[model samples]
Structure formats: structure tokens, C-alpha cells
Target: MRSTNFCLSTEGADVILATSSDEKYPPENIIDGQSETFWTTTGMFPQEFVICFHKCVIISKLTIQCYLVQTLRIEKSMSKDPVDFEHCIEKDLEYKEGELQTEEFSFPEFQATHLRFIILSAFDTFVSVHRVIAEGIAQDI
Candidate 1:
């Protein structure tokens, strides 16, 4: 049977933590579905954020839209809380000059309650994440 797909943000995933927070560029902007608005990091490299789903989900694919990101690493946590994540994937992004660098990862369905996205490095000092879309089906608890 083909399972229905959903975006984690619309499934109640929320309130992520960023290495640094700016009122004008809050982490929440990443899910607002607006390319013009984004979550920007300040101070240094290795900026990270965690998105917690309301419940466990079997994620089939993950996509990220951003700018200036050079390298990214993604981790997953099956715990009830956002802790103890295992490495899922790491990517070296290509620069697009003046466009968004969109990265899509298709994986075998896997269970997860939380996902961590770490910006390991960037083409510039700051990086902006425009949106994060996780396509999956929610697992019944």
C-alpha cells in the first residue's frame, strides 16, 4: 500500500533551538514556507538546529533549502526527547551564487522523533536556512 505523505512542520513539529537566535531571523522562519524569510546564524561555523516531531514518523525523504551552506550533517533521534541522535547523513553543498542551495535526500523509510541539522561550514560567515521539508508518514503510537 502507498502511504500518504506529510510535511513535519504541518504535523506539529516546532520550536527548534539554534546556536544563536536573532529576533529578525528566528529559527521558526525555516518552516514558514517563505523563501524570502530564513533562519540566519551569527558568530561562527557549526550552527545547528533540532526539529522535533509531535510523534514518531517513518521519514522517506528530507529536503532543505538554504543559502551559503558549504557542508551539512543530519542526525536522527528515536528517543522521546531530542537527545542521543545518530548520524544519518552528511552533505557537501554546492554554491549557487545568488540562488538557494536546495538539497534533497531520499532514504529508506526510518523511524525518528527528532532530526538535527548541523551546518558544518559555509561559503560565508553566516548561513541562512529558508525551509526544511520532511516527507513521511506518521507512525501510530
Candidate 2:
């Protein structure tokens, strides 16, 4: 297992849902399905919110042969409308320690009652993720 060499931080009320040891899905607040979960920053977001994918450290770097955004969906509590933001932050990479890293993904107008990160593929090494920052708003909506 690669040591935790990177730091994970966020701007909003972030939560960490570690999936290294759990055999089944985490609780509702953290996860809803395999490689899927609902993330909330202020805990009291009424309808829409903005989320940012900060940073992820690739220990082996080789583990993740490829990184791509599989899906991006926007959810609202009072409404049943779901919008997609997967293409909001055109996927890009940065170089660090001979590894191609992921640049921060920030959605300026990501509307959601809740936020989530859906992992499409698993890397070769034991990966640790930082917190996803999401902010709820009423004025924006």
C-alpha cells in the first residue's frame, strides 16, 4: 500500500467517506451505491449547490492508467429535475513526481440538492481521496 503522501482539503463543510475497508456500501449520507455517494457541505442546502473536485494524489500513479469523468448530475430537493455537469470542467491532467495528476474540477453553476462523486474505475494502488467541497445556495437558483 502506498503511504498517504498528499493532503485533502475543501472550502465547504466537507465530509470524508473512506471506502478502503468496507465490504458493502456506506450509509445513505455518505454513499448510495458502489463508487457513488451524496455529498453536502452546509448540511442544510435547500435546492441547489456548487461542488468542486479539489485534488487527488496518485501514490503509484501507475495504478490509474486513465482518469475520466463518467457522469455528472445535478439534483434539486424540491424539484425532480436532474442536470448533468460532467463536462463542466473539461477533464485535464497535471504533472507531479512523474505522474499525470488531475487538475481541480470546479463547477461555477453546479445546481444540486446534494453532490456526489462517481468513481468509474479503480486504480492499481490503494488510493486515498480528499474531501469534495460543495456549497449550497438560494440566490443562485
Winner by lDDT = 1
Q: How far is candidate 2 from the true structure (C-alpha RMSD, Å)?
A: 13.4
In candidate 2, which residue ranges exceed 4 Å CA deviation? Answer: 1-102, 135-141
Ten-residue stretch with the least lDDT total in model 2: 57-66
Superposition TM-score, candidate 2 onto the true structure: 0.32
Q: For candidate 2, list the clashing residue pairs, or say none.
A: 49-112
Error of 2 at 65 (Å): 18
**How many residue pairs collide in each prediction?**
0, 1
Each prediction's TM-score versus the true structure:
0.93, 0.32
- Write down the lDDT that model 2 would get: 0.28
Best by TM-score: 1
Local distance difference test, each candidate: 0.85, 0.28
